[model samples]
Target chain A: MADVPSMEALEALLRRLPGIGPRSAQRICYDLLVRKRNLLPQLATALERAHAAVRFCERCNNLSEAPLCAVCKGLHRDHSLLCIVESPADLRAIEDTGMFSGDYFVLMGHLSPLDGVGPEALHLDRLSERLAEADLQEVIFATNPTLEGEATAQFLADLVPAGITISRIAHGVPVGGELEYVDRGTLGRALHGRRLLDE
Target chain B: MADVPSMEALEALLRRLPGIGPRSAQRICYDLLVRKRNLLPQLATALERAHAAVRFCERCNNLSEAPLCAVCKGLHRDHSLLCIVESPADLRAIEDTGMFSGDYFVLMGHLSPLDGVGPEALHLDRLSERLAEADLQEVIFATNPTLEGEATAQFLADLVPAGITISRIAHGVPVGGELEYVDRGTLGRALHGRRLLDE
Candidate 1:
């Protein structure tokens, strides 16, 4: 049989996401074909547009289409306090709460030596340069409570020139609960209950 | 706070795909940024390449980069037996089994009256047009075993030309089991146990 090529292509693309398996990819492909095929080209366009146009805030490591992420560029944002997160998603999660007025620096991921990722792997150098400007007072380490996240926060704490006050986001998030799943209440409490990083 | 603008743009694009909610989309945006913000630009090219190039198969609704879908343009496929399905996902599901020999004609959707979807809405006219010239011997109606799906199958029974033998694939699937979730054995059983549509 001359197999349909598009199906295979879509399957391959969907498989690259975080949780999708072969069956999930197939289901998505099927759903797209039947229910959203007209949207396929648009979807492809959107996906490409997302990938092509978007970049990270050169300073904060947050996803951005421009040279700077919106938070880093916003004039009204609090430059005095900085919030550090593991991913752009973390930035959004904190943004959704509408409580934090501070700016963000997205680490994108934690340090993983197994993958050979080290200090150079993260934008820590850029962050050091940014913090050296002496305008910032407190830096909140809001990476997730995972071990990797903890390690990354610690590394950032050690690296940020010792002048800035660095703190982690509250960890009352039930163990094993990801920031992606945590409710605003728990997150807000955690944020309110933030402990100081003495180092 | 200078927010990252590019992240916002990427998030908007990711919001358009099926099943991806706000948080999920943000997570994807973050994942890309964290994994390697550089990869986002590469992914953009892939998306554009896919969108700019992918076209529907003239005969089947399968995605193609050409005027005709790969299956339709293929010389070796069994044009004599055309398999009818509700969506492209259905086609892929069937293909995953590696059993069927014939080409497919995707319906794009099932018949749903309450939602104002009828034969015309689903492009049954196109199917009729294809039937006029194709040397199709039999059409295997492989829609879901739902009320709407069964109705669609029955409706097509009258619409097909008298020379063609029409059969349904419901007997092979289990009751209350969606083809999307059914295992290979059950789906195979359902396909092998297909029943006549004349009643």
Candidate 2:
């Protein structure tokens, strides 16, 4: 069914967002009209500017406005250790932890041969080139513990040099989640990678 | 604890919504930075513009940019047989049904002595003035079924001339809502006012 104009366009725009449906879009549009008008333009500008200005970092494939993202350009991050992730969101997840001081190489997408996405489509060429030039001592394969992600990690392991150490992030019961709810596969993998804590 | 740059302000801006919470706001900000940067300015503009540009429709107190809203100024709608409603959303809800062809007179607030909202605050004087001059035949009291709404309806009923017929939209189980899920109070009212359909 065709919606009435003005609200129809705004509603369509809102529906394209992650969780918003048509009803929600309509409510959001009406709420916007009820509350804020001038701020709407600033929001619009930010949207256009951020989309147009942003690009994957040339070196690491993390999102950025410049040639390299903040993490890739930062002086403090260790170049010897590289954290590999699937997307910019994944990199942000790693950044939130604040436990790792190493630099990142965001893949932007995982290798999925079935979907016709191969090594060429991802930032694999840059990974190998970076491996050759940089004094990269270790590569931490922190891709999510999904089937595709595991296959991608295995595929990349074959491409990198033999000397550089490669490790995956701990696959275990989540810190706050109950053990009863944890899946058997994850529990088994966690048992396989058990480590002795100094504490 | 105090948030830096008032994350709470950002959080409040995001969380003032019906279902959004602090965590959801956090997620939304990240999501916006990630994928929805293109639409953020429009969102902000909608918010600011809605606040700055919109005002109460001088005739009905419905949200509008002009002294009189598009609904009030439209040449097509029946001007005399006014549909009295609780608020702007209520007006829109009636409009959405596509059953009502008459014009509207919105009561900005209902009568609530406990909350200190009274007849004077509700713009009843304006409504009364309009009633005196209006060539009105009927006034549909489309206020909510709540206690305050009933009280407001009673107050309006007192002021309305003896010649004008007053009516209310039937209430009951909503189109998709289960009778079991419907409040006993609302269900009773709906059944009491149920019409005998030809079908």
Candidate 3:
């Protein structure tokens, strides 16, 4: 195996991918080399194409081929409402729901000082510029409910101008999730955030 | 997301890899595009390099940059003994033990009629040729103990010349495994194939 440098290099690179372990990396290496040989060129071409073409949206920081992402350019979406999320995947998750027809601001990542991710790293200036320029009446913090996400949301929330309303997405037990199976933190949050039912 | 065809293409290609699902594919896409942008070119280069340089050992069907794999070219290994395995990963696993100083033949895959894999796909012809050419005294079937693997080993065992001793690797409780936790089938096999202890 040591004699096969190319295969080793390929396995090492695959191992660097998120969630892929050593065994999985080797499996992928073998899969590319043997079972899915045809996928090699296609994957390589896709990587090249992505590197050559994909760029962050100038307005929202979401991945886009053009200066503005599809959501940013769409006329049907509400310009007065904005949703700030940690990543493009989150933005897409929100978009998939068909709820929130508002514009978006992708932070790309949350505040993690230990990992060296700070406000500057998150493009806070760009977010501020968008907030100042856009006639946004409300901004929704759709970051995950984790500590870092909450801290990031709080940091961004404080940055919003005086007039605009700011709110965080609720933290509660997920719909269709069993109460008994829910974690303690979530159950606590769900109970604390409970609303009064109107007859 | 659809507007970014390159990203979409990259995600689609990543999704096709074994064990990667839709969400995982998107996560990997984001990881490559955002977090690990530098890895893109390196991964692409690795894929290109592997595709261009990696070739199977003409003798053993193991992946190799050269015509013959290191094991096949080694001067110290017992050329009289050959171990048959299902994949390169299995071959490496056996090699990792620092035991079995023998040559090898990689079957690449087991017979799976449901998926259309058969004898020809496993390259039994090359195995036959190697068997005929090499002065092998014993052939060990190190194929997985699964149904298809057993069938493949049995099929290949039938092809070995009359004089060469044929054997399948033992299947029972693993070396460090507790007997209580072992599955019924494996325990049954262990009981059925129990060996007599010599004083």
Candidate 4:
């Protein structure tokens, strides 16, 4: 047989996904063709459904079907304690920690000068509008500890009006991690941010 | 908002794919939703098309959209030399070697007693019919050197009638592999199958 046209098309599309290279994409495509006939239709339908039904939450910029995200709409969430994060994934991570009781503002990205991604790219105008409307007391910066993340957090801090308490998530060695294996930057950060023992 | 329904659906389907766990599926779903809007529809279409268009080649059991595989249809391929392999991927791998010009008979799987795979599972009936009809001089067993692969190869050898030459691909240390680091089984096989130097 000739090279299946549709198989090549599928491989090409799969290669465009995040973290999927050409070889893995080809393997995935082949697997789909050979062993996954039962699941192919379902996957296709799901992709289409998501593409059609999902949209950015107008309030928090998180994925939502409605105007506001789940956190934004939660009546019990602390409205006065708003946490800002770089992406929806980060918001999910903070949620999984179960320590935060506040609403979230998803920046969707950070300030990357080399990539030409700046405040405008992140739509800081929308954030400014949210801050003006909400009677928030504390604005927590939960952006990643990378250079771009720090720059974005600093920029957001400057954008916030006076009298609002600002905090950042701690950076240090991860839990269950050994000191010897920890990266130099993390070890340095851990040392610099050391706090006195509660006992 | 609250666990976007479409996003959840997409993630569930993605998790069904081989090698994709829940976390990576979630990550992929989020990336598709947030970053690859332009690609999502294309990917969906491609999957649907492949699902509809591709089928196993009837002659060789390789992936194809037509009645026969490329090698089976090629007049120049050595029809009298049929190579056997455990999967279509192995067939592709052998093709990549470019040393073999024969057509193939894809087993689709190795014989695994624990997994209930037998000669019936590999459809050796069709192979027997081919052997009776074709003027094949050599039938090469290129199954993996694992226990199941060896068992399958042994079974196939017993099935062939007398006077037909049955050969197996070599089991030895890989080219460029260090003897000190190579597994004992492979090293032993390499020594056992050593050929004399040319005069």
Better of 2 and 3 by TM-score: 3
Candidate 4 deviation (Cα RMSD): 1.9
lDDT string for model 2 (B97-164, tens) is 88888888888768889988878887878898777756788888889988888788888888889898
Put down candidate 4 lDDT per residue, B48-132, tens digits, no spaces. Answer: 8889888888878888777887777788888788899988878888987889998799988989989887778897877787677
Candidate with more favorable, higher DockQ: 1 or 4? 4
State the TM-score, rounded to 2 decimals, of chain A in model 3: 0.93
How does each model score on TM-score? 0.69, 0.75, 0.93, 0.95
Off by over 4 Å in 3: B112-118
Q: For candidate 3, lDDT tens digit of each residue in A1-199?
A: 8789999898899999888999889888888898788899888999998998988999998889999999989989888898999998899899999888989999988999989988888888888887886578999999989899999998888899999999988889999999999999999999999988982
DockQ-superior candidate, 1 or 3: 3
Number of the predicted model whose lDDT against the real structure is largest: 3
Count steric clashes of candidate 4: 2
- In TM-score terms, candidate 3 sits at 0.93
DockQ of each: 0.26, 0.24, 0.84, 0.70
Q: Which stretches of candidate 2 lie over 4 Å from their true place?
A: A1-4, A48-58, A63-70, A73-76, A113-116, A133-135, A179-199, B1-81, B108-126, B133-135, B146-148, B183-199
DockQ of predicted candidate 3: 0.84
The TM-score of the first chain in every model comes to 0.79, 0.91, 0.93, 0.93
Top DockQ prediction, candidate number: 3
Interface RMSD of each: 4.1, 6.1, 0.8, 1.7
